[model samples]
Target chain A: MTQRISKYQRLKMMNPILQFFRFIYLSIKILIVVAGGHGGTRNIKSSTSSS
Target chain B: MAKIVVLGAGISGHVAASHLRRKLPKEHQVMVVSPNSNYQWIPSNIWVGIGRMKSKQILFPLAPLYKKKHIGFKQAKAVTFHPEGDVTENKPYVLVEGVVGDSKGKQEKVTYDYLINATGPKLNFEATEGLIPGTNSTYSVCTYTHADHAWEGLSALIADMKKGKKAKILIGTGHAKATCQGAAFEYILNVEQELRRHKVRDMAEVTWISNEYQLGDFGMDGMLLSYGDMTMKSHEMVEMIFEDRDIKWILGAGVQKIENGIAHYENLDGEKKSETYDFAMLIPSFSGHGFKAFDKNNKDITDKLFKGFMIVDANYSPKPYEEWSVQDWPETYQNPSYKNIFAPGIAFAPPHSISKPRKSKNGTEIFPAPPRTGMPSGITAKLVADNIIDTIKSGKEQLHHKGSMGNMGAACIASAGFGMTSGSGVSITTYPIVPDYEKYPKTQGRQLGKTFGEIGLAGHWLKLALHYAFIYKAKMKPFWWLIPE
Candidate 1:
């Protein structure tokens, strides 16, 4: 048997109406994460330095 | 005036070079030596492979951009590292060979006050028997040119399928130790969707083959992610996506060899099997460039400079997988033996595989090597550049700027299909690329909400947005530094 996908999951994926909302929600979520700054270098603690 | 040399102009080297040039004065020269004249936004190659985007749209000539920014550009490949220089050259220099134009085959000793070895992994197609791209019905999407050929093969197959001919398509890792399952995963989905778009979906059977023990190990031990209101394993999410798309999967498969239209593989159970396909897109194993190094006395010091890829200030001691700590990962990406040398991105050797190493019953190793591309490459390169800039300005060595895969995060937007309204994407954001079990033991080494997963058209839009954004950043357009690495 193949992996199961509930009708709700399918509707959430293919339904344009729900996807539009998803698009907005994801945009905000991702923007927050990106703005929160998950990247870039941090100052190394003296103890962590190998030099 | 210090001369900083960056080898390879991929994400890592390009980022390092750009930052160094932007931060340092014109007197302090920033040079990039690479065989590839054009700088490619590699993530978009997935779109190009599926005929959604053209190769030119994803890459631009590095020479013009570098010249405009006052950065020295050389279309050459590094042959050997003379970090301690040679008899005649008292200063540290790298031996390079020209790859194009009238300077082809000419060798030159390019000296540097500081060196950044960002020469990413060499795609080792030879590691697997008969796995050459564009031959034996096999293809690759690791580069723009390779993606072009893959699209040609795929489009032809689509045409054949439209003519009432049945076709079998295979896409995944080509070798037992190949990584980048994420790219192969994205490609398969795009191809499946393309088949549907061509109205020949019923005429072809598409398969997902990989070296991963589970469906979504992704070389990071399969994340535990927050999806909507529920918490789920990455494997479950992948299985749902695959099943919903009617995609067949063969996991724990180590592809050993390829024939004209057949792939020979060994599964985790130690059984040998062959899968036949009309078209295949397989990711080859990634290996070091086999660059040799010499000291001032001309003595071979390859071990001091390289452990497969360039050796950085990371713990390389042999230890059990259980005892592997996040601190084992390197922060500064500086080579211990050569203080002036650094390696970021796939150029530096990882402390160990994020995924637990596994072996088949017959002792054939079958697990994904750690992936160190895209976000990690850019972040690591920027950190390395910042530290070098500090060193140069202070007139002393500095290792202050630091980021490690253990503490850094990566957002992977895997485009499932290509379209404004009809496309799909599976977006995964994992914090601390390497799981820190000690810090967050409850959620399998990563923070739950931060290490989340989402599937929808939104992810596609995000992926497309990043394609343009990164291209803009790479081109160093107005205020490009505003874009985060």
Candidate 2:
């Protein structure tokens, strides 16, 4: 008997495409931070940024 | 020209060596001595444990990288430290035994003007009976090899589950004073997620056992994060997740012994009990790498170390938990006895535990010790390297910087699975990692505005990004130094 695949599982199955978009999104976020002089390579500090 | 010798090539040591090589003049020498030739990014070992990633993806040869950076590398284990050199030489030196390559079993002395002890931890599997990997009843995810072994065990269990066999899985810290509960937390979630993905979640009973007094203590006494206009404690947050996932937990547990499939443990109430498991991954407590130190008079200065860790600027005076203060922690990592020596990462002795100390009715201490993970380790390494660079440039010991955990912040992403869209992870950032009561004046001892925690697919994406980004940075690709520690 085949188990029913849920919506979450279906979304997960499309991870390859989601992962590509996520990569582009994160790259832009990194660029923005670097452009704003908050490069990822700077010293550790107490700041918050979302991916 | 002065030479700086870095002991161990783990995260902290590698970071220090890389920075020193980049900043110091070519005339000055920077060298690293470590047992393994391959550097393993330990954070990804959790993924490797579940066979989500291969060991080769996370492990890389260090010799090529060191050669590219023009830094001397030795595949040897530091056996002893001679602060006061022998009669032939008056300079400080360390005796190391080659453990890899053609120099295996050969011992040599490496002299230095300054030393950085970042040997990381010696996983004390022997501290608990039946905890030894390969020969033991339980498994570990502490190292690449250990994770491989764990994956084998997990695969076998999953195969049985596919055959309609029910199995009990126990995952957590193996010792009473163990740290790195976060790794165990990550592993358990990954395991649970993997079981679900295999369509066998109902056939497995997953349980968590730890020395944490409460869930999500995470060895920093837990932090307070604001959620939907209500302040939430870490334990409360963790409990909600555990309850939703139907994962059972035994908190305040000190695992005393393991025999076959049974783990003998003692809880805070002093009650002794046993739990059975068909498959288990228990993280061991860490101790010093066991390098002996001596003074000019030939007297053992090894006593300068507490429980195998080199004592630094921290106040090591014996005191009760109530009297423990922020001043007790090391602001500067320099050894007071030997000013030229610094111990960063897990090599330095923590003054006291970050979690509130607790004892069982039988006088057994059961509390999570503080953790110095990759972020803090990298930050401290950079600070130590910078201080050393200043001293080298000025030709004077100018210890002008400190990177104490009490004043720093760290970001951690705990991955639950490897799926891009279906994957999930928890991203947590805590400022002033160690609680400062005076600064925050809150019950949780942290700034609520600065502490944050979130769980979603985004965190998993970030985790994957960091794994690749850090490896690229460590490999010293173009502008690697520009990547933040």
Candidate 3:
């Protein structure tokens, strides 16, 4: 599964236009996460709660 | 209460100080002493140089942010280090001359339990006779002011091109030992893109000149990246790009000197040549920020540094390239002389050239010095901060972390323009920035599988995103710590 994903990623990178769209897609997803206030919270909860 | 003093508020020092303020107790103080009050996100200087972004857009005052984070801020330049207290005092303190604020130009002493020297490169424009900004033949994009000036020069060139006058633009490293070929590469491409945007590309002659043995060396030697079924070296990809873009290049050329629109350089063949240009943007070589250190007895320990870079964990055994080993690289950025002092980022002297050291037939060394840019510099800063925090807690240097460039990966997005749909950029990631021969024996010092590159509008977007994201993080917004280095 990991290799398949890697190969897919590599293929996406080979075409500049495709990669641009992929990045735009990824950027949109990231923007959505940021808007949802979950963009940088993976370890925030654990680290802050412990502190 | 232990007080930590961090000199310079660059990416490395600012990040280290921010982390320390968050992790350490209120009793233990974190103080940052820097000459500049505004933290300039330097990577975006390329955009600023091209006139797509303003200097004000990329700068944020450090005082307010540090105050909000409860970190002490001193706008001052560090003059000297007193590792062992002077005759009047017994505690280690740094002599600083205030550059801003109420105490501007005033001399004062600040004591520290731990010291982090993160004063970044001193732009040695004087190294070349005509490289200085106001009195120079060539311009630079290394700083916000310099970038603004470069944009002004570029605007004039563009104006000439529009008037049907052919413009020659020479862009690359100004010194034989200069690093940051990446910046020059981006600058030249962006200039070309700008020219095309104005329909004046045909009127402008773009040329790249560098000290690298080949194109895309980027000071980590050249990397090998996979492209579809075939693997390609960086030089091959760069050549293709240059050919497609109609850009001319001169590699393995050490820029000897520059005078009024004429740059004299020597190639690897020991052949000297000169190129005249209507405009040029040359990246100057870096040196230490000129700081002297002293022992308790007031004995000068200036030998602790070489060419202004603090010598760290590596064995300083001067050996030729044939005898260079991976162990010569510093695993931990701790200064051997002072356990409490750490020089992360470009402050630390690299062990040796990451690229295979090369020389002309006449024996003139022409290889570029290693570059410690964004990713590797940030990782090293975090590691150094963690180790310092541990040492403070245990009352001894108990924790150690290593983020050597030889075992690290870096991502670079070189922007060609700042447009939503019309712009383009190149994204590249290379593993173990310094090639590790032992781990990947077959790949000639690097892991070929982990290195790759791509170009598109998406790369431009990514670069733009990073510019904002890093500045937001540097300002210590909520959950900023979660942002990867």
User: What stretches of model 2 exceed 4 Å from their correct place?
Assistant: A1-51, B305-307
Winner by lDDT: 1
Query: Which is superior by DockQ, 2 or 3?
Result: 2
Give the 10-residue window scoring lowest on summed lDDT in candidate 3 chain B. Answer: B398-407
Off by over 4 Å in 3: A1-17, A24-51, B134-137, B305-307
What overall lDDT, based on C-alpha atoms, would model 3 receive against the true structure? 0.79
Winning model by DockQ = 1
Write candidate 3's Cα lDDT for B294-365 as tens digits.
878888877864446887886568888777665567766788877888888888988788877778777878
Local accuracy of candidate 2 as per-residue lDDT tens digits, B1-485 = 98999998889999999999988989999999989889899999999999999999999999998988899999999888898887776899999999966899999989999999999999999888898875445889999999998999999899999999999999999999999999999999999999999999999999999999999999999889754367788888777667756789999999989898988999999999999999989989998877778776677878864456988888788898788766567755899888889998889999889999999999999999899899888877877888899998998987656666766667777886778667877767676677767667765666675576655576688888889988988888999987777
* Poorest stretch of ten by lDDT in candidate 2 chain B: B447-456
Alpha-carbon shift of residue A51 in model 1 (angstroms) = 18
Rank candidates by TM-score, best first: 1, 2, 3
Clashes of 1: 0
The reply for model 1, stretches above 4 Å from the true place, is A1-3, A6-8, A14-28, A31-51
The true-versus-predicted C-alpha distance at residue B282 of model 2, in Å, is 0.3
Candidate 2 lDDT for residue B27: 98
- Residue B112, candidate 3: Cα error in Å is 0.4
